[model samples]
Target: MSETTMNTATGATAARGRGAVALTVARVVLALFFAFSAFAKLIAHESAIESFDRMGWSHGAMYLIGALEMAGAVALLVPLLSGVAAMAFVGLLAGASVVQLTLLDPVNAIMPTLLIVLVVLIARDRQDSTAQLIALVRRRA
Candidate 1:
């Protein structure tokens, strides 16, 4: 191969490596945020129940939501599952945002909205990574 072609290939590989690292970092940060929230809800049942009551939801619903959050958070740590987890959180966050806007202050809705954006970004990044992996596998085959 020509020298310029080799350099181009090397640069492309380095860029892909950097992209993977950034995606991994984002996944970990998001996973930690969701996990902490879930832990709080699970450990402080009274607080969670009160929060749910304010939202016109039952205490049982609070527990169920917390469990779902915990499951999604755990899935986020797995590379293959992070995309699905992010997609799930996008839906969950959307519901939370709507509830916050309707029942609480507009300011309260901002966090869930922001989280939805982050999860969407993670989902897109994961999709790109998956596509690249599939392309590589096809090339090998």
Candidate 2:
């Protein structure tokens, strides 16, 4: 192959590698944030319960939501499952944002809205990763 062609290939590979690394870092950060949030809900149930009560939800609902968040956080760490987990988180965050806007101050919804955007970014990244993997598999076959 020509030197220019080789250089172009090398640059493409390096760029992909860098993108994968950045995506991994983003996934870890998001997972940690979700895991910690879930842990707080589970370990310090009183606060979660109070928050749910204000929303007219029962304590059991709080526990259920906490468990879902914990499961989603774990799934987010797995490449194959990350997209699904991020989608779930998007839904959860959307609901939380709506509740905050309706029952609490509009300012209270900001965190959930921000989390929704973060999860959307993760979901898009995961989709790109999945597409790359499929292309690789097809090329190999």
The Cα error of candidate 2 at residue 36, in Å, is 1.5
Most TM-score-accurate candidate: 1
lDDT of each: 0.84, 0.84
Q: Lowest lDDT 10-mer window, candidate 2? A: 128-137
Candidate 2 per-residue lDDT over residues 106-132, each given as its tens digit: 898999999888788788878865576
Q: For candidate 1, report its TM-score.
A: 0.77
lDDT of 1 by residue, 46-106 (tens): 7676788788887677778888999999999987678878889999999989988888677
Provide the lowest-lDDT 10-residue window in model 1.
128-137
TM-scores for the candidates: 0.77, 0.76
